[model samples]
Structures are given as C-alpha cells and as structure tokens.
Target chain A: MKNLFISAALVVSALSVSSCKKDDKDTTPTETTGTVELNMAHRWGMGADNFLLNMELVHPMTQDTMTFTTFKYYVSNIKFKKADGSWYVHPESYFLVDLATAGSEILSIPNVPTGEYTDMEYTMGVDSLRNVSGAQSGALAVANNMFWSWNSGYIMVKAEGTSPNSGSGSFAFHLGGFMGSNNVVTVKTVNFAGNSLTVTGGHTSEVHMTVNPAKLWHSSASLATTSSLMMPGATAKTMATDFYGGIAFDHIHE
Target chain B: MVVSLLITSTNNNHSPLFDRGDFFQNMRTILFIVAISAFLFSCKKAEIENYKEWGFEKPSHFPEPHYKFENNTQTYDRFDLGRELFYDPILSLDSTISCAKCHAQTHGFADHNVNFSLGVNNTVGKRNSPALSNLAWYPNFMWDGGINHIETFSFAPITNPLEMHETMTNVVAKLNASAHYKEKFKKAYGSETVTDQKLLKALAQFMAMMISAESKYDNYVLGKTTFTSAEENGLQLFKTHCASCHTEPLTSSFGFANNGLDSDFTNDLGRGLVTQDPNDNGKFRIPSLRNVALTYPYMHDGRFFTLNQVLDHYSNGIVQSSTLATSLGTGFNFTTQEKQDLITFLNTLTDQNYLANPFLSEKKK
Candidate 1:
C-alpha cells in the first residue's frame, strides 16, 4: 500500500511538471511591423518640370528652364497624425535634400511603431536656434557646404549658377536666418484627404509630396535686377517667402 | 528561512509544506532573479553614437558650457581622430602645413614669433593665428565672428588661398584615397567613403575639445588659488574698464564692436561686411583674453606686438566711430604701476597646463 501511495504522488508531480513545460512553450509569434516610404518630387512653376543643379537639367516637376549650380536645404521634424489622434514622430529627424543627387530621393523614415496615420507635417528649413548656435552633426553637418562660414547661419536655400536671365556672370543666393524678421523656417502640413492609412503589421505605405522651385520667384523680384544674396536682407526674405509658398501635397499610396 | 524549511520538510516531506519558511525562500529567490535580470537588461541597453563626438572636461566651479554638446556627443574615438587630424599635414594641399604649423601647442596653440601665418606657396594670411584654447566655451570664432558653427569653422582656413589652399571636394577625394583615413572615417562615420561632412566633423571633434579654463584666473574664481595683491587690483580695474565688452568667464562676449583700431576705415569694416549696416562699420568681435601674454602681435592686423601697445590702444587711442563700443567711449588712463599690475593680471590668464598638455599636443603615432 505504501508503494502504491508513492507511485500516485509521483504521477501527480509528473503531471504538474508537464503543465509547467506547456506554459513555457506559449510562443505565439506576434506579427512583424512594417514601414512607410516617403517619395518626394521637387517641382517648379506651372510649366516648369525639372530642377537645375549646377546647370544640369533633371526632370522633377515637369518642365522648367532653371539652371542651378547649388541647391541644398534642410527638412526636419517629420510627424504623422493618426485618425485616432496619436502622433508618430520620426526620431532624430533630419534630412538634407539636394536636388543634384538621385539616391537622396528616398528619405527613409524607420522604426515607426505600428499604427494607422491620416496626415503628415514637416519643416521647410532648419529651426532658427540651430542657425544661431554653433556646430552640428548629421543632416545639419556644415561640411555639406550648406552653411555659410563668413556669416554665421545655415544657407537654408542655396541656388547658384550662371543664368542669361541674370545680367551678372553668375548668381549665388543663400537665404537663411532663424531670428526676428529674417526667420525663414516654414512648417508645412498635408491632410491625407480623410483616408485612414493602415500601418498595421505586414503593411507598407508610400506617400508622395511635391515641391515647386519656381515659387522662389512668385513674390520676389526678378533675377535680372537682383542676382546676389549671400546674407539675410530684404532680398532673402522675399525669396524665401515665394519659395516656401510653392510646396504642395501630392498623393498617398498604401 | 532555509533552516525553517528544512525543519518543516523534515517533519513533513510528502505533503509539500506551505509554511512561512517556504514562502520566504521562494520570495527571496524570485527577488534575486529579478535583480540579476534587471542588471543584465541594463547591460544590454544599446546606444546609437552620432557622427560627431567630443567635449570639454567640466571642472568643479565652471558654469554650464556655452557651446553645449549639441549634436556632437563625447567619445574617446572621435577625440583621438580629431587629435590626429589636427597634427597631420595631410589637410594641407602640399603636405607642407598642418593646424600645428601655425597654432603650435608650445605657444599656447598660438603662432610663435610670426605676425601672420605663412600659407602654401608662402602666401601670407590676412589675420594672425589666434591662440586656440578654451574653444568649447567660445560662442563665436575668428576675430570677425565670421564662422558660425564649429564644424564649419575649418572650411575657412582649409579653403583660404592664403592658408591650406585645398578645396573641400578635393580634400575629400584625397582623404578617401588614403587607407588610414578610410579606416578612421569608417570608425567615426561607419563608412569608408570620406565625405566633406565627416572631415569637418572630425576636425570639430578636435577643436571643441580644446578647453583652457584652468588658468590662475580660473583657479582664483574656483576658490582653489588666491591671487596676489596686484592681480586682485588688476582684476578690479579690468572689471571697471574692460569687462563690458571683454566679459568675464569666457573673457569675451563674442561681439563685434569697434575697439578704436582702424579709424580711417579703408577696407576692414569688421562686422559691417556681414551685416551691411553702416553702424557696424569698423567693428570687430572681441577676442578672448586667455593666453593674451603669449599671443602677441595683437589686434586683427597683428600690428601691436606687446601688451603695453594694446593697453596704449585702449588708453589714449580711442577712435570715434558710430560702431565704437560704448564701454570704450573714453580711453583708459593707466599709470605705469597700474599698467604693470594689469599686465601681471593678464599674465595669470595664460594657462600653462594647456600649452604643455600632451592630450592637445601631437599624439605620437
């Protein structure tokens, strides 16, 4: 009888151990999160199609006769708001958009927590404080030739090269200053037309945005009269306003 | 708890004792496991190092740094890279000049016995090579306050026809060709392709680490050392006369004001060129007083070779201009004894440790 009792106890203990092992094996795989890719196409005026970098013609907008030698600007603080009113901010958000390069078109927004989004927002230029402050890294790296060494500030929008339209042999206008009246940093917002984007597990979304370079001349003076702007002044302010006004939301694909 | 568990188990082994002793032992084991797991998790925490890194060593009494570690974080590798580039002649177009060629460490990082630095092809630069120290605290760079960001600072000297005379694109190509530079760039920027961005960042890492706030003046302020009677008197006089523009702590407000140097205003309208404002004509940024005793041939033109000449400029040579600093409305009248005392105080601003510090000097390859 004692042996029978010992055997029954052992069976009970064995069952308990088996149940513990079963609990440890509950590895139901969670769904893998996906990412959204932002494809930005820089455009210019109504008929203008291409962006000119160092006098090289590249079709980006549709058709434009603008020949540029230097074109560089900073885009930062990208955030997308969901229909549920939650925000997905891209961490360490900084990007130097140069029209001269093709590979730079794909602005990667990574490690976004899985969620649904409805709208997007971004800044046209670097914040004012960063321009005044000294030294920076990554997208704001001064070595990219986007910064002015003589006058302290990021050349927020550098458009230079020779143009017959311009009376002078060449032109260089580096418009940027984040302080007082000269602050050119512009924030842009685009609504997704009320369509909810499903950023769920195993999903990918692509958003297309359009930027116009001819907007730089919208309210500003003609290139014939004014050709040079290396510092912040009335000319820079006018040029920056016209350029920022040309930015528009293109479309979203999921 | 173990003993109690043993006693309880000794009394009743078959029926699985559920007493306080067993409960306590189980709780203790769980807590220990949790503690160890927490420690391991913290150890596994990953860090994403940025492209640039280097910082000033904070002393006990120093104020919050002016050039706060912004995007540039502090790291030992980046600092070493910057130190190497600082002493390397490869930055020059002809391999004949390096940063150390002009800013020698023995002279408090100021050029010794030369008014203007001789560049490639023996071309003379416009400005003197200023003493380079306590840079992490400086808000602006160059006498004209022309260069804004520290990362972009090297571009001026590197591309200046009278300096290194190397183009940024060409410099990147040259560095990319070198295997050693490729490895260094890979370590710092995670890439073998040497770009202008990485080159400037590495140079910044070196320049930003040049802090020189440990002079006798700094020591006196920190309460570590007491100044002599003459030094104290000189300090008081400096506060009354020179402290308005040449502020304390950093010893310069990083402003552009005409200090009565070039009254005729032929071409050197210091701050006026940047602003294009007539009021800023003939104005220049105030320089830091650190190592003022050694960085002779003073002023932007390097015309004054002695401290007394600089004092005389401040004393009887007050030039009237719209952009002249209000603090220098009237020239300072210092007696011979007072001049000597002021010079003595200025001598205390020289950081001997900075001049002789091996960390800032050329690192033996």
Candidate 2:
C-alpha cells in the first residue's frame, strides 16, 4: 500500500513538473493578450433593414424589387493602429462572410496585445498576393466556391438574387480583380471618432460595422439593363467600388 | 503503461503462484501495446519520408520558375501521385476525360494534330489546347492568362462544363472511395483523407517538373552546337521582328497581346473578357516557342494549321484592329527563302528529349 501511494505521488509530481515546463516554454506570455471580435452586422439598402436570404426587399436606390438567394464577400488583411502610432497586423486574417452562416459574420481576432487602438484598417477583397499564390486552405479554399475555377482569382463579392425587373428573372454579380488596371481590391480605414477601443486581457470586445448591399447598384445600372456579371470588368469596378465604399464602422461595445 | 499497471495489480493480489490466465492476459496486452506503438512509429517515419526535400534541376540559361513550391514542398511520392492523377480519368464526371486526354505527353503535351480537342462525351471545345511544356516558367496560364497559379490551373479543366465537368467535392469523394488512392494519399500527405488542395498540389508538382530546356536551339544557345547559316539568319530575323512580344530564351512573354487575329473582336473577346478593358480586346497570351514544331494547330483558336500558315499570317494576313500590336501593324515582309529559314530555326526548337522523356510519361501499371 505504501509503494502504491508513493508511485501515485511520483506520477502526479512528474505530470505537474512537465506541465510547468510547457508553460515556461510558451512563445508568448498569455496574461497580456486579449481577443477582439469584429461583429459585421449586414443590412439591406439605406434603411439598415435586416438582411436575410430568400427575402424580398426593395432596393433603396434602384427601386428594383428583388429577392436575394446568396450574398457573400471576403474581408481580409485586418490591422489595428495603436495610439502609439504602431500597427498590430493580424496574421493570416482572411474571413469569408456568408449570409447563410450566422457565425461567419462575427470575425474573432485573438491574441491581440492589450492596448488602446485608435483606428482599424481592413481590405474589402482578398489581396493580390494570395490570389496569385497557389492552393490556400480554410476560408480561401476552392471548396467555398468563392474562387473562380477558370480565371483563378477570388470572387471578392458575390450577390445573387431573383428580380422581376430582369429579362432573365435573376441577377448574379461576381466582382473581383487583383491585377494592374483591373484591380478592385479596396483598403479602408475607420478613425473610431476619438473613442479609443480598449482591449483588456481576458475580456472580449466587439467592433460593430454595418454593410449596405444596395450600394452595389448605387452608381451602376439596374438589373433590367444588365442582370449578370460573371467576370471582372467595368461594371464590376463600379459596383464593387460602391458596395465596398459603403461599409462603415458604426460603434464599439466594451 | 497499462500492462505494467496490470502486472503491478496482479502481483499485489499476493497469490503464491501467478495465475496462468492473468499472465496470458498481461502478455497479450503487452503485445498489443507494442504492435500499436510500432505502427505509430512507422507512421511517423513515413511522414518524415513523405516530406523529404527533392531537388529539381533548372537549366542555367532559363529564368527562375514562377512556382517555388512554397506551400506544397516537392517530394518524389507527391510527384508520382500527381503523375497518376494526371493520367487517370477518375477526376472526370463520367470517368472518361483526364487531363491527359486534352494534354497528351506526346506532341509537346498539346492535342494530337487537332485544332480543338474533344472533351467528355466527345464534346468539342472552343479553344485549342496549348502545349504544356516549360509551365514552371510561365507567369500565368491558359491563352488568356486566366489562371494565375500552377496549383490551381487543373481546377479549370477539371470543373469546366466542356472539359472534365466534375466538381471538386465529387472528385474528393471519389478519391476517398478508392483504396489505391487512399494508400497513395496516405503515403504522400500522411493522411488517407483526400483534399482539393492536396490533389491540386500533387498535380502542380508533376506539372512544375515538365521542363523543356534541352532543345537543339538551347544547345546552340549554350554553344554546345552550331546553327546553320540559314538558321542563324532566321534567328536574327526572329530577334528583330518577334522578340519584343515572344521574348528571347523563353520565346514567350506570357503577357496578353493583340496580335491582330481579328478586326471585329465580337465572337470571343479573348483577354478583354477577363480584364474587361476595351483596349485589351482581341488580345491573347503569347505562346512559348520552345516546342512550336510539335505543338501545331497554332494560335489561341488554332486557326493556323501549319507553321507555313502561321508565317504567312505574320507576313501578309495581319488584320487591322484598334488594339492591334504596334509592331504587328505592318506585317513581317519576308521573302520565301527568309520564311523557309525562319521555319528551319523554329524546327530546331523541337526538344526530342522532352518529347520522349520517360520520367513524364504515363506510369504503366
């Protein structure tokens, strides 16, 4: 009985010693790190109505009554600027925000250093480097159907819907380009309006941002004029610009 | 560890002699643990062997390859798997058209003397299948520079409606179902589960190694041989007339150019369709002249049947267009002798070694 008790004690001590060694070997001191969740609240039109798939919604600008079946886009290369003029760039920050998946709307950026961020910067489309690079996994995987199989570039923004105003009875706009003269990749920065976002360790903070889908046709023609855009070009440039430009930071929740 | 614990518990029972049944049970447990650990250790060794770095020989004269295998490290096993996939028709919807169906190893990896290759169900395609040699050096793929990466290049043909017409998801499922492929995948990727990334990377591994830098022209350039006087004259003519677009050594800029193929540009917008730039209408990627002799049915649409016809098109048949190449506006006014000499020089680019390279050929079962 004494031998068994001694053996058990030795085993327990060995396990505890190994675990302590592991904690000491960690690359980053975990106590000072916190997670920042950027909750992208998507809405339809200018009225900020709830954006739901398979729901009929009248366009605020075009006045074209439409029922959206699919809406998804890529948001990547997230960076937060500190009050000290230094930037904390998130590594491998690529997210495919699909309307069908509720959790995809909330992009959780973990391991952020505990600090006050004055501005946030993000790219609306997948960067040119990743588009040219071969065979990406996770959100950038080809299984997601966001990538063009033939052209080999990400469809930065995809909006498919049915409309009575079109001759084909449907509209599909897949906008993307990542090369010179044809690039639609946009980088936008939001100033936080003098309110610094303080990320405390062990506490999750949310940065709420609003997206307006109606801005896609803001300066472009109605669905009746052109219902489909499978490849990137002039119409894609205008539509993607308007839509990407419309994304704005609303407020932050501590 | 469990066997030792069991032995300790049995010893603690204080029996005068060890129970034969308990002893046998403990032996069996020890054997099982040994077997499991041995299997796990072998798996770890296999994984290390799978990722073992293999060097690819790049010719001294040639430029650096566009694909450096950053994500998918090169291994012989992965390359072999890619070769198997390239020749296998299992990736197709009906299990008929593999990548090799359109891209044969012979004839410089282009279709066999056909203007446009037939796909699954004998369905004719719109564009001529381009040669597949020296792809590692190509900045972009296809005649329009549509595909950007060598790894993702197979996805176009595999999923194209007129090509293999199979979805990536379905391909993965089919590969998973095959015990032969499962074993191959396990050997290559350390997992029997197949993925689109693995499949594409494997294909890229095989494709990236299809180098064609041993042509007679290459020999002449490297001072290993001498070009005939006529061939030399033709080379000079080519340098003065065509080297701007069809750059030297590589014989391709891999950039889109409006070579005056069409004046209307209505039927197929070509690169313009991809770029959406009005100025880019009637533009197509300049093809490599590495094995131009074998990869006949030339041009994007394979409009020209013979090299003579191609030369004729350059000499007198250039159509005027708004987006016409500035150099090609006035055609190359060459005499019949000059044309013959140029054709001779072009023929010297036929790399017989590349055409009959046993390494790139279909692996016979």
Candidate 3:
C-alpha cells in the first residue's frame, strides 16, 4: 500500500512538471520580435501594368502615350494595430519612394513586437508639423529634391514624364500642401480582412500594397491640357486626392 | 517577476521548503530601489546638460522668442561653423556671391543701400534684401511670410534663379568635395557628413544669436537711459498712429497687411501669392522698425528709399486698395515737425553695438 502511494505521488509530480513546461513553451513566443516590411507596388495604368521608369505606357483615361522619367512621393507616419487594440508606431517613419530606385519600394520596419496585427495605417505625405519644423534628415532631406525651396514645404508627390501629347514634350506635376484649405495630406488605413498577420521570432513579414499612378489623372485633364504644375493649387488637390484614394492593400505574407 | 521566478525554480531542487513569495518580495524591493536611483540619476544628468548648454538670452522686457530651438541645440562650435558658411561664397552657383554680399553687416545686414540686390552672375532679385537682426523673434520669414521657419529661409536665396541659383544637392556635393569644409563640419557636428539638416541648423544657430536688444530705445525702455523730449513726443504719436501695426518693443507686428503700397496687384501679388486668396492681395509683412534708419530702400519692392519716404507713404502716399489696412484711413496727417520727431525716434532703434559686435562679422581665417 505504501509503495502504491509513492508511485501515485511520483506520477502526479511528473504530470505537474510536464504541464509547467507546456505553459512555459506557450508563453515564450509572446516575447519574440520580428521585422515587418511594407512593399509598395507601383503601376502605370488602370489595368495594373508594370511601372518601369522611362518605359512608354498609354493612359487608359487620358489615352496619352507617356514615358515617366522621375516619380517620387513621401510616405510617412506608419503605424500597425495589434489584435488586442494596441498600436505600434514606427519611430521617424518617413520614406521617399522614388520609382528610379528599384529597392526604394520596399520599406523595412524593424524591431516590431511579435504579435498578430490586424490593420496598418500610414500617411501619403509628410505631416504638417515636420513641414513647419526646420530642416529634416533621412527621406525628408532637401537633397532628395522633394522639398520646395521657396515655399518651405515638402513636394509630397512628384511625377515628371515625357509625353508626345504635351505641348512642351514633357510634364511635371509637383503636388504638396500642408495648411489651410489647399492641404493635400491623406491618411489611409487597411484591414487584413480575416487573415491576421502572424509575426514570429527573427522572422520577416511583408505587407504588399498596390499604387496606381494613372489615378493621378482620374478627375483631372490630360497632360496635353495641363502639363506643368510647380506649385500647389486646385488641380494639385484633385490629382493628389485621386492618387491617394487609389492606393489599396493587396496581401500580406507572414 | 521573471528574475524571482527563475531564482525560485533554480532553488527548487536544493531546498524543498523555500519561501518563493518572500524571495520575490525582497527582489521586488531591490529592483524598485535600483529603478528609482537610475531615474533620479538620469534626471540630474539632463538638468546639468541643460544648464551647461548655451541657451537663448531672453531679456526681461522682451517677449518670448518664436523659435524655441526645438531640434537644433545651440552650441558655440555650431554657431562658429554657421558664421563661416554665412560668409562663404561657395554656397552660390558661381562662388562670387555670399549672403554677406547682399546682407552686409554695416548696412544693418540689409544690402548696401541698393534697391534690388544682385545675385550670382549679376542676376537682380525682385525685392529688397531685408535686415537680418532679431530673427529669433520673427514668427515667419520673408516679406510675404512664405518661409515659415528661419532655417528654411536660406533655401529661398540659395535656389532662386535670381539669387544664389544653386541646387541644394550641388551645394552639398561641393561642400563634401572640400577637405576644409569636411573638417569644419566634423567639428560642428559629430560626423563629417554635411547634410542639409546640419547645414541649416548650424546656420540657424548663428542667425538665432543675432539679437539686437542693446539699442538706445531698449536702454531707454529698461530705465538705463532717458529719451529726449522730441523722441518722447514721437513715441506718443507713434503709439496713437503706428503702434497698432508696428507694435512697440519689437517694432513690427509680423502680421501681413496692405499699407496701400499699390492699388493694382498685377506686378506682385505679395501675400496673395502665398495664401492664394484674392482678399490678401497687395498685403506684405509689416517691416520691423528696429535699425530702420540703416536699412533704407525699404518696403517689399524697396520702393521707398528712406524713412521719410516710408512716412510720406503712410502720411499721404497711401494708394486706395481693397486690402488696405483700415488703420490707414486716409493718411496719418503728420506735419514736418512730427515727421522729424518720428525719424529721430526711429534713429534710436539702430543698435550700433549689434552692427559692430565683431562676433557677427566674418571670422578672419
């Protein structure tokens, strides 16, 4: 009877130890960290065509044949929302996405806490505070040629291309505004549908987003009518809004 | 909690009767003490650093400066570098025109009595170069208040086709190529990389220190000296007529106003071009009266050659415009005596100490 009691106690202790180990294993992954990369895919036309710099492409709406030489825009204030309603804000989150550079499309946000993120939010332009604040580094640097020297504001979107339809044989649209009625800063948020983004330890998760350049001329006139815009105005407002609205989250690779 | 848990688990085999709760409580107390000490140490360090750094000198009588130096911390090395860059002609496209070429120190930092200052390759600018003093007090920069920050103000002349006419990228490249500039940059900033931020901030550090608070007017206001009877009378008249727009102490109200400079806005829209509102047509930033005597050829287009002309414009030369300030009803009906008194009072604003401060002048390499 004593021997039987000893065996039962050993079995109970073993069960308890095994259960504790399982609990430890379950909790360890919650402390893991990983990086999340935002891949912005740019396309030229409404049909989701490849956006190659210096490649000739015809706009579906304007029907103007154009070859883009330079296309760059500011993307900033990136934030990720976890499943538990907490947010992870990327520090100094500013990027100048230029079409000329191949790797510029991928914005790798490192040191993100491991968790299942439900939504991602980002701004289409540099914030007004940074615009008013003097001098900035990284992507918002003046060397990027995305800053307006005269007006003291960022050129949030720049699209320069050569078109046969244009009067000057080229078109340049520099869109930006920070304050008052003509402000063009746009904030966009996208949910991952029902698919939760699982970020594992030392793993890289990618969120792919599609950007349509043709949407810039969605509500505006053809390049033939108005080719050059060096300042912010009503036409810039319409074009920037259309382009910002067209950006959508496509998929996430966890 | 994790440390305590690990300790308890590690000792579980050695001691079966170990008091896990007591161990955890003791560990928590120790951690609390350590964290408190660390926080206190950091706070003390921060306070010492703040006191050690050179801060903005705020006179008791003056209002708080508009620029708080939020990002750019003021330092002696940074200011020295900025002074060198301000006097360097390498910032220009042709390396012939420095900022000092237009904004000379002797002429109250305004161009040398020129209505329109010339830029690189003898390119003439549209408007007069304003005096660069007490810029830290300015809410916005330029005649139209287009440039919001003082750091960004340099970008206008540097890139303007009629000014320095140099791209920021090209300027950076040139600075990078120079071994001397690289060494200066290394001394100012920790690294040798001459970025736009470093360049602008260093310039801002030098410009922010261009305070002109030692004028005769400032002395009189501070009870260090007394104003003459004519000057005192002019001050009273100025209060009644001009003080609303050109506020006292700092001299100008930094707000946009159309002082009836023109009836038509076709030539230059002034503030209208920036705001894009037709109502703001012909409106320009109120010119500061500090060192007004030295900074001649005033107004946005430098149409007025002297203080007398400016006074004449206010007294009689105010053209009818829709955006004209309501204060300038017809004109200030100033007699010759009143004009002379106002001019005498205005002369007291010239800070001779600031102009010849030697600190603001070009360093003799």
Would you list the C-alpha lDDT of every candidate in the order shown?
Answer: 0.76, 0.88, 0.87
Clashes of 2: 0
Runs in model 3 with CA error above 4 Å?
A1-31, B1-55
**lDDT of each residue in A108-220, candidate 1, tens digit only:** 77666677777888888887777765556677765677777667788888887776666775667888877677778889887887775566554567777777776776766
Instruction: Flag regions of model 1 displaced more than 4 Å.
Output: A1-35, A48-66, A106-116, A129-138, A194-204, B1-62, B68-77, B146-152, B167-173, B181-205, B213-236, B248-250, B264-266, B272-279
10 residues in a row with least lDDT, candidate 3 chain A: A24-33
Provide a comma-separated list of chain B TM-scores, one per candidate.
Answer: 0.82, 0.85, 0.84
Q: Pick the candidate with the highest TM-score.
A: 3
Query: How would you class the docking of model 3?
Result: medium
lDDT of 2 by residue, A1-254 (tens): 99999999999999999999888867444568788998988888777898889999998877899999999999999999999999999999999999988799999999888999999999999999999889888889887889998788999999998999989999999999887766899999999868988888877889999999989999988899989998777778889999999999999998
Q: What DockQ does predicted model 2 obtain?
A: 0.57
Candidate 2 — which residues are off by over 4 angstroms?
A1-30, A180-182, A193-195, B1-54, B189-193, B228-244, B326-337
**Model 3 lDDT per residue over B199-221, tens place:** 88888888888878889999999
Candidate 2's docking class is: medium
lDDT for each residue of candidate 2 in B32-116, tens digit (9 for 90 to 100): 6677667777776764464343246678898887878888988888988999999999999999998888887778999868888
Candidate 1 versus truth, CA RMSD in Å, comes to 14.5
Candidate 1 interface CA RMSD, Å: 2.8
> What is the overall TM-score of model 3 with all chains considered together?
0.85
Q: How well does candidate 3 reproduce the true complex, by DockQ?
A: 0.53
